[model samples]
Target: MRTAVVFPGLMVCVALLAGCTATAPSRVRVDQAEGGLPNCKTFAWIPTPQQPATLTEQRVKTEVLAKLKEKGYSEAEKADCRVTYVLDVHERPKNKPSVGVGAGGGSGGIGGGIGVSLPIGKRNEQAGTFTIDIVDAAKNAQVWSGSLDATFAKAELNEDEAREIVAKVLERYPDRAPN
Candidate 1:
């Protein structure tokens, strides 16, 4: 009896841990114009309409800036390309446990057992997508884009962790700015 109860609890714990262990982003995608990208050595931030300034946004911008610099792009008032990002975060339903109650009787005696179905997969957690776009400032057309989907363990992300995620998404970008 103890083993049955303990085993279910242990399985629950393992499932929760498995969900928490998903730190890397998935569904990464990148798109660029057919003619490749325009020669852009400098970039400027283009405000995303309706996006309020927030800590998460700030962290993303900071990390993106650093990554762009590393890739030979600099921010300036007059730039060859414009940069912007969109973040979409929404709650995702986790696999929930189910409980079933039933009654049974046998000719020898009456017997019953309660059964519970426990979720052994993703627990209730938040998932989100981060997308970055680079547009030609003069032509007002997008040149390149990168995006990643991730399951966030927490509602809020610290700077360091956010940096790592941003870096991963940016990995799809060119190694250096287009000349």
Candidate 2:
């Protein structure tokens, strides 16, 4: 009897934790080592019209800047390397949890649940893909290119989450800087 009531609560906690531990962005496979990306840490942000419904061009810029700065990248019009990133987002899975009423409020049948509509199972998988390309002013071609995928709670509410995701995407640079 007691176990019956505690089991569901325990399960719900597990589901929420799983959602947060989903995935981190990825690194682009590039050739070369040493003398690739400069240590100046100069990066910029560029948004596309086809981006996710979660943010506006202005907000994305703000978020990206914050993320980069948080990672120790300074804001400058010019630096050793030119970094520009484009954001693309697509909607994947959106799961709504159908919670049946368990044993609650004296409504004793199977049980009762809360009125919240949050999904208990899988959620709508929203992805934020960033295309970061570094251009060498001396050479007209792109020197480095990287992409990152981030899953968000909702497609429309992306501003807050973008900071964390974009920062993570750029975090790869510290390790991937050409061998």
Candidate 3:
């Protein structure tokens, strides 16, 4: 009984103390960079609140670089073509989506307080922000750049998940290059 009662507190504790980072698409929709190439691609990423611009950032960068290299955009610009990508990461605060429940049979006299909500529905109020960014690596300026948001689950990231998500987001990159 006591453990059950402590569940809510624990949930709240995790929600408030533990950092929840969800990765979404990109942010920058427009590009201001000058110069154009048909085959060059550049990239830079900004870290999220949970993960700052550090070693973890390098991991993310390396992933992007690998993908770009694989796509054959690493030397796109050198060939006097068009290709460039500017990326960044950022985060914001969000209310935990949650649900609620309450058992009342007879009368009541100010049951709970404001913050103390008795969930009557599913827990859909787990508040947490996301870590995402915008990737622009199109022809002239921005041929591809979008935002991304994700939730935090693993302290150490799994490469498979990272690649899949990044690939999914890039799938929607603007088509300035030859189709």
Cα displacement (Å) at residue 165, model 1: 1.5
Candidate 3's displacement at residue 70, Å, is: 2.7
TM-score for each predicted model, relative to the true structure: 0.67, 0.47, 0.37
Segments of candidate 1 deviating more than 4 angstroms:
1-27, 48-52, 96-116, 119-123, 177-179
Residue 142, candidate 3: alpha-carbon lDDT: 41
| lDDT comparing candidate 3 with the true structure | 0.41
**Per-residue CA lDDT of candidate 3, range 1-179, in tens?**
11222346645645653344344554423322354223334444432357455444455556655665566455333332332223333333334444443322224332332234343543331222222333243332343334444443343335664565556555454333533
lDDT of 1 by residue, 1-179 (tens): 12222345555665675577565637669999988898888888996668677788788889999999998888998999999988787888677666554444455454445677887866678878888999999999998998988767766767876898889888888866354
> Backbone collision count in every prediction?
0, 14, 54
- Top model by TM-score, which number? 1
Candidate 3 stretches greater than 4 Å from native:
1-53, 75-143, 154-161, 174-179
Question: Which candidate ranks first by lDDT, i.e. highest?
Answer: 1
Report the Cα lDDT for residue 117, model 3: 30
Ranking the candidates on TM-score from highest down gives 1, 2, 3
The lowest-lDDT stretch of 10 consecutive residues in candidate 1 is 1-10
**Candidate 3 accuracy as TM-score:** 0.37
